[model samples]
Target: MPWEKQFDIDEVLEKAMTAFWHRGYTATSMQDLVECTGVNRASLYATYGGKRDLFIAALKAYDESGRQALFAKLEALDDPKEAIHRLFWPMRPWHPGLVSCVAVS
Candidate 1:
C-alpha cells in the first residue's frame, strides 16, 4: 500500500503560508516550516517537493481561497456599489487573526 499522510495537507499549507507571510520567504527556513507545519522535513520534501515548490503551492492556495471568499461575499450582496465598497473597506481591520492578505514582510 502507498504511504499514508498523517497530517492534513490544507492545515500544513495554511501554517506554512502564515509563517512565510510573517517572516517572508527568505527569512523562513526549512526548520521553521517544519516546526510551524508540525511535519518532518523529509515528509515535507517527499510530499511537496522542495521549499520553492511548497511556497508556490501555498501562494496558489492563498489565491484560490481569497477568490472563493470574495466571490461568496460579492454574490451575497445585491448592490454592485456595496460589493465594491466592502471589497475596498472590509468590516474588520487587517491583522494576524484575520489573515486578510499576503504580507510582503
Candidate 2:
C-alpha cells in the first residue's frame, strides 16, 4: 500500500508552511495542519514524524524562500537603505493578512 499512497511532499510542505507562517508555532494545531494540507492525521504523522518536525521543515523552507526573494531585491537595488525600504514597502499596505498575527498593540 506504500505506492498507493502517492501524496506530493512538496505540496504538503507548502501548505503546512503557509499554515505555520500565518498562525505561528504556538497557535497552529495538528488538526490545522491536517486540514490545511488536505492529508489525514495518520499520513501526516507518518510522513513528517509529527507536528514539531514538520513545522521545523516548513520554517526552513519558508526562510529559504524569503531569503532568496530578499537577495534578488537586494541585488537589483544595490543600495542597502533602498533594499531595506523595498523589502518592507509591500507590508505598509493596510491588508487584513497581518492583522491575524499581530498582538494587541
Best by lDDT: 1
* Candidate 2 lDDT tens digits, 23-74: 9988999999989999999988887799999998887877888899888868
Task: Give Cα-based local distance difference scores for all models.
Answer: 0.89, 0.83
Candidate 2 scores a C-alpha RMSD against the true structure in Å of 8.0
Per-model tally of clashing residue pairs: 0, 0
TM-scores of all predicted structures: 0.75, 0.60
Q: Which stretches of candidate 2 lie above 4 Å from their native place?
A: 1-5, 77-105
Could you tell me the C-alpha RMSD of candidate 1 in Å?
A: 7.6
Per-residue CA lDDT of model 1 for 1-105, tens digit only, reads 889999999999899999999999999999999999999999999999989999999999999999999989898999988886777566446553653444422
